[model samples]
Target: MSKALSKRFGEESMDRIITWLEMQKISKDVALLDIGTGNGVFLIELAKSGFTNLTGIDNSSTAVELAKAIAEKEEVMSLKLQVADFLHPFPKLSQYDICIDKGTFDAISLSPDHPAEKRSLYQQSLHSVLKEGGMFLITSCNWTKEELVNHFSEGFEMLQELPTPKFQFGGKIGNSVTALVFRRK
Candidate 1:
């Protein structure tokens, strides 16, 4: 997962997304969850930026262990790393102010298995752990702006669309990766 993530999302892509998140002025008191947070890279960055309440969950046990090690080495005292699957039910008390997914959605969508059912459950799980009006930030290379917005229309309101600046063949505007925020309603 870590290697795949690194290959899919470059430093520049992460920098842009982080910059946009910083612009949101998220309060330190608010809970933040990073779904599929492999190695806690984004959580470490958030910790460095003074966000104290952070949680990262990944389905892979190895990824969770790596994230824990990274968090400890970086002295991210407030981060809680867990091994959990988004397709299953989360605890009732697990509510968050914000939830982020960098590439998990794309992976689920591209998998050969029951992608639609798993995707639906994943969205529901996100909503279950997110407070009303809480934000869900997703960065995906598999979905376009319209596809994502439409896909999330059932339970979330599209808040914003952020596109990566990579220029494809003929100087076209859009890139493989697209970033978007949706507010739970």
Candidate 2:
């Protein structure tokens, strides 16, 4: 059986993003990203939809390698998984057409104190990767959509705020979970 994640990080959140991806006329050539990409499961789904320009980045080496293995075993060609820390300096900007951050900002926001750094890192990392006029989807529960917009909207414009995503608990399968969505403008 596959492992499970907490209710906050469950499939409901992914399904929300998939809806956004579907709304996009995802072609075989547009770049797609899954930042804080744990195991690259989200990228796998996007790849399944014929988005060939899929790239995934994670902070853990083991996770990156494991995601690569899983992608290989599944024969997925629309992916390039990497081990990268968003806290550090990043490369050139205007790279990808769309950036999907499943929960990277949420994890950073969960840290004790340091809202300034949390917001800054979110902006810089996102800035360095996304192309002008590209789409960025930030999924989180650590902050409400309004909070996320207020804190990180200095560089990014507010495009759209989708409804909150919900899921069942990992331990208690009957309970439900909710998460917010922010789209980059």
Taking all chains together, each candidate's TM-score versus the true structure is 0.90, 0.80
- Which candidate number would show the highest lDDT if scored against the true structure? 1
Poorly placed runs, candidate 1 (over 4 Å) = 1-10, 170-172
Per-prediction count of colliding residue pairs? 0, 0
- Report the C-alpha displacement of residue 150, candidate 1, in angstroms: 1.0
RMSD (CA, Å), candidate 1 to true, equals: 2.4
lDDT of 2 at 114: 93
Instruction: List the global CA lDDT of all models.
Output: 0.82, 0.71
- For candidate 1, list the clashing residue pairs, or say none: none
Error of 1 at 123 (Å): 1.5
Clashing pairs in 2: none
Task: Give the Cα error of residue 70 in candidate 1, in Å.
Answer: 1.2
In the range 1-185, model 2's lDDT, one tens digit per residue, is 12465544557677787886678555667887787888887788778767787888888999999898889888896588888877674673247878877667777877788957876876887777777777777766556656766876666776776666445665543223224333455
